[model samples]
Target chain A: MSTVSHNEITVTGLSIGYRHKKKEVVIASDLDFKVLKGQLTAIVGRNGIGKSTLLRTLARIQPALSGIIQIKGTPLTAYRNLAWAKITSLVLTEPIASKNLTVFELIALGRQPYTNWIGTLTASDTHKINEVIDRLTLNTIAHRKCFELSDGQLQRVLIARALAQDTQIILLDEPTSHLDLHHKVSILKLLKKIAQETQKTILFTSHEIELAIQLCDKMLLMGSDGFPFGTPRHLTDTGAFDKLFPHESVTFNSETQTFQVRD
Target chain B: MNEKKSYRLPFFLLTLVLVVGFLVNISWGSIHIPFEETLNALLGRPTETDSWQYIIWNYRIPKGLTAILVGAGLALSGLLMQTLFRNPLAGPFVLGISSGASLGTALLIMGASFFSGVLTQGLIGDISITVAASIGSFLVLFVVMTMASKVRDTMALLIIGLMFGSISAAIVSVLSYFSSAERLQRFVFWSFGSVGDLSWPQLTLLLTMILLGSILSILSIKVLNTLLLGEQYAQSMGIDMKKSRFILIVATGLLAGSITAFAGPIAFVGLAVPHLTRQLFNTSDHRILVPAVLLCGAILMLFCDLLAQLPGSAKVLPINAVTSLFGAPVVIWLLVRKQKMVF
Candidate 1:
């Protein structure tokens, strides 16, 4: 095997899906990609295209149907649960169980893996949490309850939680789904800044393909015919974006670098 | 953190109030002993009336201790259940623990009469009933947990827990139908729930269970906090779901089961105390909430016991009834005023 420099996550010939008892439902297959360090990657596709499933598979929230997910050159299954947690942090779109928790306390939970037996936050833990809060610019709302936060603010707080975990890789599932266009771009920009500044691998599943194309360093475009993984320009030049949605409904305008609604 | 300071004052006040509540519980009972005399008896000094000594040392003290154990155990288990199931409504009663104990006690005190009607009412020892109830609660919890492991869904487990309660309740009803009228009366007394008749040995056993359950709850604080993320995110953060669930179920069983075994399923305390504590404490971190439940539970139960005693009258209200009569309204008031039940 060649030494892939700065490769944080590498998936080869990967098949992702669900298994019910004996039957295997393969959602996507033959996915091969390299998620580089210090880069923001996006998984873009139509609904039910297994973009979230691919992210979950890479995060090991669920098992892949077949193929290898190598995290920093080691098989994902080879690491224990704790070891995997120390390397990759996950942010789901699902709401937290309790909204009574304050912003600071909730983010402090991301330090669970490193905390003491009783989950007490030591000096270092507090320092790390403060650094994350400051980095994410959540100072004003740090004392507010989660219920007090708006969707955009909550999304930032959730991202702050993942960052506080101090993992090398972060995976998010449709992070910008419910937010408006302004928030979606703000979150993407924040993610890009975080990935570049901290040298962490960040991948998120998003429906905002136009924003993703403008922001992401790499994109994994999911399709039934074939999954293409590359830089946005490379993928665009190869005419992949035009094949994303149905041409009758919408088409990609390569000239303006955006998707246009058809008449 | 400065926030830790704000909570510390409330915690200190709650502990102080608990101490005051305990002494008040001892001071005001069917027989009136002055607070100073009660303090003397508590301090192992001589009291003015010898009957006061006998009553305080022999009855009130043990009764108070039993109330504390029962209250703390139930409330801690309730908090554990709420956190484990991630449902604000979950508690020992909802999970069938109390009913399981009822079934065990029914099987022993009444089910035997169904077989031959040979054994007299006083023939069975108090210890035997306690043992039977403990076994019953643990067995049912074991079954619920086994299914939880298989299903891997918290909501389904909650439904299964309710179903177990219903099934045990049905069985208890059948046993009641077959037993003699005297046996039926005895079972009814047990169901009314008492904190008074526990002997020293029964108190010791209940104490052991409370100790172990509290220890387990302390150990589970980290896991419980993680669980607040919902199980999936918790699992993603390196929490072993099966192992954590098993420990929590065991802790809940020990606390809920043993209290039911000794005290006969005193209602309302387990479910109400956690909400009350959360309302006051203003945070869900189990590190604070666990010990907070211990004090809040004991304080609330002791206060309720004071009301049950009725101070001047020798007649006592059933603890189970008194708990609901007083506790339900307070919880309702809190929820109505706050516009939310603190989870």
Candidate 2:
């Protein structure tokens, strides 16, 4: 909303895709969106939708076919690797083989962008990491190896790593995919609280549209045909939720903020 | 403050372990040298017996140091390769670097027989197989690096490395087929691995190469740690995966290639040491893992080298055979225990 600062991320006319054998397969094109600072933005779509691809593009993990993504009004390419790392961090759904890493060690890695050539963490860096671990409630298991943690705890550990990065914007892909309902709500609540408290922009994708609509400040709804972006209320009122599901049984109920199926 | 203390403890213990391991290595060998004698010799104390002093200085000291250095080098190389490829199984031997060194040594030993002048002029005597081995190691390393850059997936790169190793093995077999019995025996013996064969000069060169390569690997720890999350994550963190991969491969080659050149493709230590170190330290931060693996590798290799000497007998088993005896079971145990440890 209007709370978005001048330094917020702006994607203009973004055409995103990958090149294979000299052929461009565009996932989404002519996409224009502005992500407000300190807001939790949910990207919701059905299976095979370009939600993950769009998130990847926004995080600069994948190249946009032909478009401009600006951070603080500067083109994404203007910032060097360390500069970008300092500004943005990402959490993926893929599991990593961080066998030897403790939760604290893994979180400490978020300070890599600021660490010196020898990769030494300074006192202030350690303080920041401890603060994130405490923020994520990971202090009890901070000494536990990543491999030893449960899926829910590991997910929080990953978020702690991102928090330790001290970035303005964080992009996550299906962070709730593998979690149980309790963990899912906990992680979403954590993200929402982080967005509010830290003033950090968070863009995440999920198949749980109803949950996202309730928790997020704004939503980007992508479908097979096109994508529509707006606040959850605006999108729900404009019938954007109608196009999300294929069956006629389910309908989006704006007043109750819930999904219903006709008898 | 407590967290900082916890982190520092492992580093201090690792340093202590390395120091103790080095001393134990010096004391235990084929000859039953007492700890006092070894310590005296190490500290420049004169012994009453010239032969004891000579034995410690000329033979045991260099060989002992070589084992430590070679062990550290191979373990560090394995750690770097595994991190760079993001494959737990990836190592110099898995990637064909060892096979390449063997092939190069085969070429040198076989090619020398063809030129009588090469043997007569003492060219074969001075040339040393280590040089040929290093060349071969570098060649395969370059090929692997090139292929890794072109390929996007870690599994594909691992497969390509295996393929390169197979090709090198094929070439080595061809060379062995035509070589003279004497030359074949030499090549075969070298392939079995031995830390005892290195002279002082060769040991110095090996140390220098390994130290330089390790320094390079340490310098890139930040990039490597980022890479643990995955290449895409690493890229978003501002690391150019291509450049970092190139540096890592070259560094792996230097450490792996040099050790193979001097020690003759010692097996098990490279694959097992890093894994063991990772388990012992329970941390993937390369800053800790790197040195921890180095010390663990040295200790394991030195212990194996001692076993190879076969105390109180003239019979010396191939160092590789001794290492494999200990190494293979550790790897099997690791595989069996895989369910317990998550990587």
Candidate 3:
């Protein structure tokens, strides 16, 4: 249970939010958790619960309001941008302003931190990219423009891009928000498989709590009162899932381990 | 991989058109020189008539070269702006650098008249105007650069640019209203845009500045491609957003400001050529589009310059008039023909 050496990300007393014009608006504070390597972890919460803020803060895209975030025992801020890029990657929910890039080219761009000044792919870069494309079953559409892709295919491609980045950790924000139920499950399963196979820590934020509890090895449940991080069953047994939503509208059925309406 | 092959034929045809356009532009001027004589003059062979050599060397070649340089410069500038803003409508002139140049020109020509003799000398007048235009543009560039550091939103930057443009335009209007008839005419003529008036030294300066801008743009190819993925993604890829944006804006300002100073704000080449290149090349890769837009811009400018000369007649149309009249329809045609825009 103590996998401190295998921790990909560790936070101590972290507070994440935004500061505007000398005014600080804290979304979540006093957070502490560790994400283990070779596991799929999901951060789940209701609307406006600072899921994205935590991901962005962990990715080092936004400054953490306060506290310690250490990646492999190094302070998050201690790593330079380029070096951090090699250790962690992000797949965002925002629509890409893609021009004429093929799926292959888009994936190859994941090597930006490692590529030469002009971003020309080397033999190994191309080899890694090809491997990702094949693993994701994207060979048929590798030559297609990213904008030409279906939502399911594009999500796979985005994950493939993160894999191609060759990072020890990947952070995703709502990676399956726009997909159907089947796609949502498939994507989560794929993420689980990728984590086990590559031994990389993969964390994503999603609203699909039931699916997350089913597939994820670990879960970070953010509530209005507290943030709890533990294995899905551990959190469930600890009564963390029941307090996630308002008790008036919904209740967590510990037997089924799913949300049920209080009729 | 095979996508590259699709652009080969179009690239070949574009090169052919550029060669033909270059020759046609040199050959078809007032007091027509024979094609053979024009070719001979271009090859450094002395033609039978001295006027042919004088016209070809002093006038035709520089004008032709000017068209190529400004065309490429403006097109690349437009490409940079569009990529930086991620807006299809963005262009080199979007930041109001041209208006700033106009304000400078207006102040020099109009405000200098109040001094009577300070800027009226031949070479001094020309130098003052160039200096004034550069001053005006750099002033705006400085302001935009300062604002760029503070503003992260591209649309906000665009709006600030428009505001700078409007303020300069208003100042120009006031200057024009208070100026004498002859000074006002001079300012109006400059606004008409000219490719034929650049002397050898001026052309040299234009080519050099454009070369600098183009090199900066080339250095930014990787960053530009990353930017298409949006800012946060680009940053995650290790791109320094502030540095990339600074280089992009500075490159755009240099190319746009210099071209406007010399060519008097040639229209449509920068704005239209990039869109046209994107359609024809069918790729958003800056590596391909940079060179493709460069050639397309040059060819389109040569064609416009050729038309502006009115070919058989002596009277030349204003270059701006020809650019909008000719370039606007091509953009409209591209828009009307396509069901959805790629970018």
Candidate 4:
């Protein structure tokens, strides 16, 4: 792994939402957070709580209404598509149609920004892709078409593609949503190992709050009213979990670090 | 993996079949020339007589070449449209550009009766129809591109194209109602499409335009592959989405419009050839798919033209009828098998 350098993504006073015609529907405002280098962060929320919106805004997939997103002290908007692609890689939640693409061909798409006009991969590009595939344990099925693989395996193939990009930051929206429990844990564990070993920053959203609390270095909890960001211990100590759920039905169990229903 | 290789062997066989088909087409005609005489004439060797030379040079050679070019062009245009719209049912006719050309031809034929002096004389009298058809195609191509800028959905664009075709069809019907019987017969014959109508000059023009457009598409294989994942994914891969879309649309328009202008709305070759090539090659890589589709299209067109000759009959069937007879059954089989059509 290369030595980690000034790896930081900062968002300040960021307001995100959609603007159609002249009207604007803001999802969240005054959101400020700094993701540190070489750490795994999980953004957790219930359905429709703006978790995906926030991730999209940060990744520059959608336009943010107000405020700035800076990577290494440079504004995100200043970078064109090619430069931006080199800096950040994204894994979307939708399933892609893999007609005749093998796992290797799909993963090679990550090198698009670096490829020339004819789309041929350089020696270094192939080496980096091979390294990523080997690291992800995708060597056995590397020749198989993506359509023949299971959902869990497909998810890994996508992540492998992101890794092949060799970017400083990787953002995935619900990377574990389609996996079984064992595959979920294994994927999360693999991500954690990647973050530490490669010294790359990784941010992903998930609804598995318990697993996130146990595995992530930092957590961002988004709720109906607003959002708060901190380490899991800091959030628990500040009673941030108390407001996440309704007061009537469920409560946060501080001892077991899980949610439970009131008797 | 070996099965994939074996599946591709038929494509080679198809090429052989097309060559034999072309030779057979050159043999049969009103002249009744033998196969050896035609071959010797084609090879530039001394023939027994000069009549066979004139028949082979003036008639059979240009006709055969036009069939191959038109077939390849229409098939390639259809493949591009299918990929662009992500719909298996989409084809060159769906865009209405062909209908627009038909309307232009109708206007020329109908206008000639009222003002004979203005219509009858030109730089090239017989060539006016081809020029008018090209102008018609260009006009419709411009309108569709303008509309595509506003509409983002693939289905919506297709519907708009169909609507454009219908409007052109309505205009052509009005013109047909007023045309003289002789002019109407000429226009109707053009609409059925045939390789025999092409003069040497028209064949040269068609060859240059179609080959240029096809090469442009071949160079765009990388962008097409990325687009298969969808526009958003393609954008994230550093492709300028708007620019890529514009270039692709222009190329498709040039290919489809020129073929329709030269040959009359030859259907099904564009709609069915890509699918057939996919089944034969078993690969989705555009680098492979594009060339395979081009060859397959040439073979299909040559075979259809051969069939159009009707062996020993005085009457010849229209080329469009022959192609549809071959193309429609394959499409029905594909739909019945429920093969997933990935754009």
**Pick by lDDT: which candidate is best?**
3
TM-score of chain A of 1: 0.98
What TM-score would every model get versus the actual structure? 0.95, 0.90, 0.96, 0.88
What TM-score, to 2 decimals, does candidate 4 have? 0.88
Tens-digit per-residue lDDT, A1-263, candidate 2:
26535548888888887879689998778888888888899998777678888888888777889989998788987888889999999999988756557778788878878878756889899989989988888889998777778999999999998898999999999999989999999999999999999999999999888888889998988876677888898998898888777656677777877778966
TM-score of 3: 0.96
With candidate 4 superimposed using the best TM-score fit, by how many Å does residue B172's alpha carbon deviate from the native?
Answer: 4.9
- Tens-digit lDDT track of model 4 for B1-343: 1112344576668778778878887788766788999999989997899989988888888888888888888888887777777677877667777887887777777666667777673532446787778788778888888988877565687898899898988888777788778777888888888778677888888899898889888877788777666666676777877777777778788888888888877888998998887766656667677777788888888888888887777677899899999777876686467575433
What's the distance in Å from true for residue B334, model 4? 6.9
Model 1 chain A scores worst on lDDT over the 10 consecutive residues at A1-10
Candidate 2 docking classification: medium
Candidate 3 iRMSD, 1 decimal: 2.0
- Clashing residue pairs, backbone N/CA/C < 3 A, model 1: none
Flag regions of model 1 displaced more than 4 Å: A1-3, B117-125
Best by DockQ: 1
Candidate 2 Cα misplacement greater than 4 A, ranges: A1-7, A247-263, B5-54, B110-126, B177-182, B328-339
Measured by TM-score, how close is model 1 to the native structure? 0.95
Q: Which residue segments of model 3 deviate by more than 4 Å?
A: B1-9, B112-124
Question: Against the unseen true structure, what C-alpha lDDT does each candidate score?
Answer: 0.88, 0.81, 0.89, 0.81
lDDT at position A247, candidate 2: 55
Docking class of 1: medium
DockQ winner between 1 and 4, please give it.
1
Q: Candidates ranked by TM-score, best first?
A: 3, 1, 2, 4
lDDT of 4 at B309: 84
Instruction: Select the stronger candidate by lDDT from 1 and 2.
Output: 1
Q: lDDT at A220 for candidate 1?
A: 94
